[model samples]
Target: MSLTAGGPRRDDFFKVPGKGAGAPVKPGEKAPVDRTAALSVGAFQPVVAAVPMPQRLFEHERERAAARAAGEDATRQLKNVGADVDVALTTAVLLLRGVEHPKARERVVGAVPQLAEAADYRPLDAAADFLGLDHEDAAEILEELTEHGVAGPIAEAAVRVEELRAQVQQADHEQLDELLEFLLPVSALISIAGAAAPLGALTEGDPHLAEAAKAGVVGLAAVALQELHSTEHPNVELESTELLEALTPPVR
Candidate 1:
């Protein structure tokens, strides 16, 4: 009766037979695929990581900014220490010149406590007048302090410090570490007279004079610290920070 002998129409070319979208395929034949189905206009989004692209970009920018800020801060601090160190070097040289004094006789000890012990050192007010020199007078003062035998290890240490500073100027990392290992002893190097007497200012009446003397010793020590810690002012070998850290005891 009907012209077609079927359940559903299949006149359209490539249309599925017997069933619509879910039709089964005959043996040795491929199933129909719906190429015309609605598709998303943009990129296909598979499951992605938690932190997305925009946030990752922002994080990278933020970290970069922080690093730059830190570098600028370090540079400023280095310059400031350079000035402080210049005064300290002159004070130290002046103290060296007066090494024959009765009150002076301590060198090379753990920086935090050893050098500051007044019982171990004599007064250095004789060098006080030198502290007023220009902030950049370290070279001239170094020349003065380089007197052999009298300055002892202090002079030797200072020479090595300058060499290290040159390495720092060149930003030399390759050889810096080796030099640092050698300089560890430099930091501890101090020249002391054979025997130091007890506090000589007992009858001087002026306690401040003794205090002033302590200031010079401390100043010299401070210069040493600065030489090893400066990260800017275009200063010393081994980045100083790394060297100083190496001196610290490791965490258990």
Candidate 2:
């Protein structure tokens, strides 16, 4: 951006000689100019009408008023458990629509707690943590995917995570860690599975296993490697399926 002088331009400061002014004087004397008779004109005028605010500011104030009303309505609805349910559903719909607009998203995020309270919906603290990590990780993955290409499941998973994060408001530390541990392994496994499905050679002799191993897919890859070995790599098979059988979701 170019730097502009602090005040009015040179054209604005230049004063023209007016009628009934004194005669032009020599070097030491004053010029014959009528100061009082001068009409000053600026090079540029303020295009905006001073009385009315900018269109965006006006709309912002209007939206703020609507958001305030919505908050009050939410508070009132929350007092009645039955009504709160309806309000929560309505808020969810609004939030889904508003996600396309950042300002609207901000408004909806601010109202989430009130909506939950009004609806008597138990706020899952764990869900909040999930949202925060999901947002950060998804943003990173998006940046990576921009470079890596969006042809695979990893890209799709990142998109899904981004969508989920947009809905959150109150994520704290402990809940976030739990969510990360739950999500990473599962999503990494899914991504590897997706990578392995097409053009088998491109993914290596065992595309699924290779992708899983590449993504560090916990022990799920090992189980999948064992199960599918007979079809694709009969020479390398699991000694026992007991490890796969014992795998269970961790108790929360």
Report lDDT per candidate.
0.28, 0.24
Best of the candidates, lDDT = 1
- Each prediction's TM-score against the native? 0.24, 0.17
Compose the digit string of candidate 2's lDDT tens values, residues 44-109: 012111111112222332343354455643322222221222222222222222222444234433
Q: Which window of 10 residues has the lowest lDDT sum in candidate 1?
A: 190-199
In candidate 1, residue 89 scores what lDDT? 29
Give a tens-digit lDDT track for model 1, residues 179-241.
223222222211111001011132423333332333333344334433432111111222223
